[model samples]
Target: MIDKKQWQAEQAQFNDTSRYNDIMDKPRHVSHAHLPMTGRDRAGQFAPFAALTGYHELLNKIAQRYVNKKYPTGAEEQAIFDFFHQLPTGDAVRLELTYFNGESGYYEHYRGTLDHVNWAQQVAYFADGPQIPLRNIRVVNRKGNAHGQG
Candidate 1:
C-alpha cells in the first residue's frame, strides 16, 4: 500500500491543477525539465515503495537519459523520483522545466523576453510519463508560473 505520510508529502509538493489537454503537450501541472533520479540503493532508504514500484527503475532510465545534461546530483535525483513516482508510467518521457535568472529562486516570470519568442518557452522535464507533479517551474498556461521580475 502507498505510505500515507510519504504519499501526502509527495501529493503536497505535486498538488497542482493537472490536466493534460493532449498527449503531445506538456503537463499542465509539471514541466519536462526536472527529471527524478532513481536511488542507486533501491534495497534501502526508499525500499518501502521501491519494493513494489517501477519508479525506481524509471528514475534510473531518466537519469541515464539526461543525468549528465542537467548537471544533477544524487540527492536531486532522489528528490525528483520521490515526487513523480506517484504517477502512472508506461512509455518513457523527456521532461524539461523553468528557466532561471541568476540564483534568486525559480524562473516564474512571463515577461515575454523576445516579444516574438518562437521557441516553446515552456520548461521541459523528462519522466516515465506526463502524470507527474509539476510545480515550482511553470509558465502562463503552466501551473507554477510566478509573477513580476527582479
Candidate 2:
C-alpha cells in the first residue's frame, strides 16, 4: 500500500478544479427529448411495492392446509347446548369457545368473557367483541372448570 503522504498528495491533485475552468460555472443541461417528471412521479419509481402479487393467496392456502370443518356428534352437541344454557346472561364468565369457521373450514378457538347471548339471532356475544353463531359452536369450556364439554 502507498504511504500516508503519497495518498494525501494524490487526493490534493484530484481535488484541484483549475483543469475544468471552461465549464466550472456553466448551467446544467436540460433534456428536450423528455418532459420533466413531477416529484410524485419520480418517487413512484423507487416507492415500496409488493413484488409477489399472489402472496396473500399463498398465505390463505397455507392457513387452510388442515381445514376440514368438524361437526359435533349428537351427544357432543347435546352437551354443548346444555353448557350454553347454564351460562347466565349479562354475567362475566371467562370461557374458551371452540367454533367452526365456515369461510376457512376450520375450528377457531376464542378465549374471552361471555357478555350475553342474543337468542333471537342465535349468536353468543363476547366481551371482546366476537358474536359467534350458536350452530357453529363445537365446544365450550367455562374457565376454572376442570372438565370441558365438546
Candidate 3:
C-alpha cells in the first residue's frame, strides 16, 4: 500500500477546481437574445430516448393476464335465479359477482352488497355502482350462505 501522504498528494492535482472555475468565470460569447435554446428546450435535448418504441406498452400488455367471461351451467343458472327471487325487499345482500368488463375485455370478480335486481331489464345493480347483465354473470355467491341455502 502507498503511504497516506503520497496518496493524498497524488490525488490533490485531480481535486484542483481551478480550470473549471476559470472556464465558468469567463464571459460567454453568445448573447441572451442570440441563444437558440431555452432552459426547457435544452433539458429536452438530453432527455432519455426509447430504444424500442411501444416496447414498454407491449411488455405491460403481455404481463397483464385477463380471464375470459365464463358462462354459467344450467344448475348454476337455476341457483342464481332462485337466490335473486328470494331476496328480501330493500335488503342489501352480500354477493360475489363475476362479470365482464367491456373496457378491459376481461371478466373480473367483485364482492359487494346487491342493491337492486331488475328482472325486466335482466340486470343486477351492486351497491358499489356496477350494473351487471344477468347473461354476463358467471358465478353468484351469497355471502354467509352455502350453495342453494340462500
Candidate 4:
C-alpha cells in the first residue's frame, strides 16, 4: 500500500476545481422524458423486496405449531349441551364462549348474546354475527354465572 503522505499527495490534484470552471455554476440537469417522482415513490424503489413470496405466512403457520386446538372434556361438553337444552329457543341470553379454531389450531374466546340455537343445522348463532358449530364449542356459560354453572 502507498504511504499516507504519498496517497494524500496523489489525491491533492483532484481537489483542484479549476478544470470544472465552465460547468461549476450550472443548474442541475433534469430529464424531459420523465417527471420527478415524489419522495415516497423514490423511497419505495429502495425498499426491501420479498424474493420468497408467502414466506411470512409460512412462518406464521410454523409459529402456530405451539398452539394446540383445545377440546372440551366430557363434563365440559355435557355442561355446554345442558346450557343449550335449558335455554328456551329464540330467547336471547348473554354468554361467554371458548371454542376451538381448527384452521389455526387455537381456542378463541368470545362474549356475546346467544341469539338462538339451530338444532337442524347443529350451530349456535351469536347476536354479534358468529355462527359457531356446537361440536367446536369447548366452554359456554351464562355471562354472570361461574363456569360450568350454565
Candidate 5:
C-alpha cells in the first residue's frame, strides 16, 4: 500500500499535459528525404504475412469430413437396380437416398419424393430439386417401406 499523498502526487505527474506536449513538440530529424506513409500504407507494413501459402487451405481440407464411396454387394446392387425399374412413371415416390455429394466430397442422406428417374443418365431427380447419380448411391428406401424394399 502506498501513502495517499504520494499516490496523488504520482497521479498528478502522470496526468501533466505540459510534459507530454514538450516531448511531442520536439522536431523529428530524418537523415534522408523520405515521403511519410499514409495510414493504409503504414498498416500494410505491420500486416500478417503467410509464411506457407495454402497451409490454411490444406489444414481445412484435412479437417473436413469425407465419406468413402460405398460398393454395394451383388444382392444389394440388384435390389437398387430393380427399384429403379419398378418406379411408377410420372408418380412422385418418396425415397430416402444416400448418395455422394461431389461438391462437399461427402456422403449425404436425403428423404424426399423423387420427381424423375432418368434410366439413360442413371440419375434420380428429387422433388425438392437435386439430381443424384445412381452410381454414387449407397442406400435407398421407399417411403412407408423398410430399407432394401422398393
Candidate 6:
C-alpha cells in the first residue's frame, strides 16, 4: 500500500510557489559527455552516475502512473523520455524529491528541502534497459529577470 496522505503532501510541496517551473521548462541546451576520461585532461568530467532526490518515491510514482500497469522495458524509458522531450523546453516542473532517496518507506514524506531541482534539459535516451534511469538532471540556477530579482 502507498502513503496516500504523505504523497499528496509531497506533491503539494513540489508544486508550491517556486521558480522550479521556469527552470524545468527551458528552451536552451548544452551537452555533456557520458563517457569518462580517466587519465587525460578531461579526467573528472565524464562520470555517468546521476543523483536524483526522492529516488524511490519518484520512481514509485512514475512506476504506478506510467510503468506498473505494463511491462517496464526500454520502450517504457522511451515513452518517459519522449514525454519529457515534448514538454516545451521552457516548462519544467519542480517536484519535491525525498531525502535518503526513499531509503525508509516512511521517509517517503516530504521533508521541505529545496536541496535541488532538475532543469529537465533533455530526457536521457536508453535504447534497451529494465527501466529508464533519470539522467541528465542539470542543476538549475534560475537566472533572474528585469522586473524582480531571484
Better of 3 and 5 by TM-score: 5
Tens-digit lDDT string for candidate 4 (1-150): 357998898788778889999999999999999999999998788666645667777877776753685556788767777778888666668888787766667778888888888889988888889898887887677755544422
Better of 2 and 6 by lDDT: 2
Which residue pairs clash within candidate 6? 24-92, 25-89, 25-90, 25-91, 25-92, 26-89, 54-98
C-alpha lDDT of residue 130 in model 4? 89
lDDT of 4 at 14: 73
Span of 10 residues, lowest total lDDT, candidate 1: 110-119
Q: For candidate 3, lDDT tens digit of each residue in 17-123?
A: 87798588777687677757789888787666645667777666654533454556788777777778888978778887666675576877788888898999988
Worst lDDT window (10 residues) for model 3?
141-150
Compared with the true structure, model 2 gives a TM-score of 0.48
Clashes of each: 20, 0, 0, 0, 0, 7
The best candidate in terms of TM-score: 5
Clashing pairs in 2: none
lDDT by residue (tens digit), candidate 1, 1-42 = 357998998887787535533553654466479764457754
Query: Model 2 misses residue 109 by how many Å?
Result: 1.4
Error of 6 at 55 (Å): 23
The TM-score between candidate 3 and the true structure equals 0.46
Candidate 4: 10-residue stretch with minimal lDDT: 141-150
Residue pairs in clash, model 5: none
User: What is the Cα root-mean-square deviation between model 3 and the actual structure?
Assistant: 15.8
Query: Where in model 5 is the C-alpha error above 4 Å?
Result: 1-67, 147-150
lDDT of 2 by residue, 24-109 (tens): 89998889999998998987886556456677777777767536756556777667667778887666889887788766677888
List per-candidate RMSD values in Å: 26.2, 16.9, 15.8, 15.9, 15.6, 28.4
Residue 44, model 6, lDDT? 41
